[model samples]
Target: MAPNMADDVNRAVSGARPRLIVGISGASGVAYGVRTLDALNDLGVESHLVVSRAAAMTLSQETTLSLAELNDKASVVHKIGDVGASVSSGSFRTLGMVVAPCSVRTMSEIATGVTSTLLTRAADVTLKERRRLVLMVRETPLHLGHLRTLTALAEMGAVIAPPLPALYAKPASIEAMIDQSVGRMLDLFGLDWAPVRRWQGMAADAPE
Candidate 1:
């Protein structure tokens, strides 16, 4: 192999940990992103987090956790404007990026490749690298424009994973339901989170 190519690969793998980018948008249910970081910590996977300004506002409105508390869950935190961060480059190898609570605006930016912030830029890099880009959009009552934008993202090979409550899990609280959804989202990256309620066969529940 060429020396330059070898060096590039080496630089991308400079760290020992398998990295993944975490983007928290302005959409509600910031817990999805929070729990994602928690799961990454449990799995020993490195997390690079970038939070949009709007998301910070949502965080304040939805939960009592401070911004510092939210950032503490991540392995490494990047500013929303820091486009020069390692994650902003595709050569920085990783498992890819996931935007939990992806807002329609962020989704549209990524879909159009018109990234104006570090969060969307990192996602753009992930897509350009042919890596997995998962967006857990948290909006309901979707209009025609929203549907079209989602279709565009899907066409670009990005997964649109909306966080929906699973009644079959028999979740006892709102937290349980959120964990279930976040756990399922992690499944796309092959990360197994313990909080997820698996579906056993009907025979397993039946008495012998």
Candidate 2:
């Protein structure tokens, strides 16, 4: 069993903010990953980021920011191929792993236990260590393979979250929508967020 880093931290270290590992796959919703890192940083959570080669390609095609500028947003950044990194080990405790905009290819790899890169390895380590592993899969028009992989991962304790919007939030802009989605994702990990409005329901006294 992996030692709980939260439990083992000294008082001095324990005072530091929690760390979360954010991985970006080659999926279309790179925006989700970028926005998620920004939101986590805003919440004072330290983030370690890893971007796959395909993800880098997509990011370049989709966003104006350079990879370095993107990496600067995170507290620490690791290359996707760096399997020797601290995140690949269970000893380096993290709050959890979130693969925002996870591609179908990446999901298949995770499902099959294929750790060709550090991102996959870290995810694998997360599962083996029984830590929270959330994958925000971004594919649309899903196929049988995608469904099977999602099912397998879910069975293995991975949360397969897609980048679907909530109709109730009634977001005004793309940024707002992204924020709401990221906020909902964080909620899965028991993190409170103020990025989007929460549902308070109708006032009890005023409601019919």
What are the per-model numbers of colliding residue pairs?
Answer: 0, 0
Listed in order, each prediction's TM-score against the native is 0.90, 0.90
Could you give me the TM-score of model 1 versus the true structure? 0.90
lDDT of 1 by residue, 1-208 (tens): 1113233334435767677899999999888899899999998888999999999999999989999999999999999999899999887888778999899999999999999999999999988877778999988899999999999888888989999998989999999998999899888876788889998757756787
Model 1 lowest lDDT segment of ten: 1-10
Error of 1 at 190 (Å): 0.8
Which residue pairs clash within candidate 1? Answer: none
Give per-residue lDDT, candidate 1, residue 88: 90
User: Candidate 1: lDDT of 99?
Assistant: 98
Evaluated with TM-score, which candidate comes out highest? 1
| Model 2 RMSD in angstroms | 3.1
Off by over 4 Å in 2: 1-15, 202-208
lDDT accuracy of residue 146 in candidate 2: 78
Tens-place lDDT per residue, model 2, 1-208, is 4434444333213658788889999998888999988988888888999999999899999899799989999999998878999999987877778999899888888898977999999999888877778899998899887788899999988988897887787888887888888888987766677887788787778757
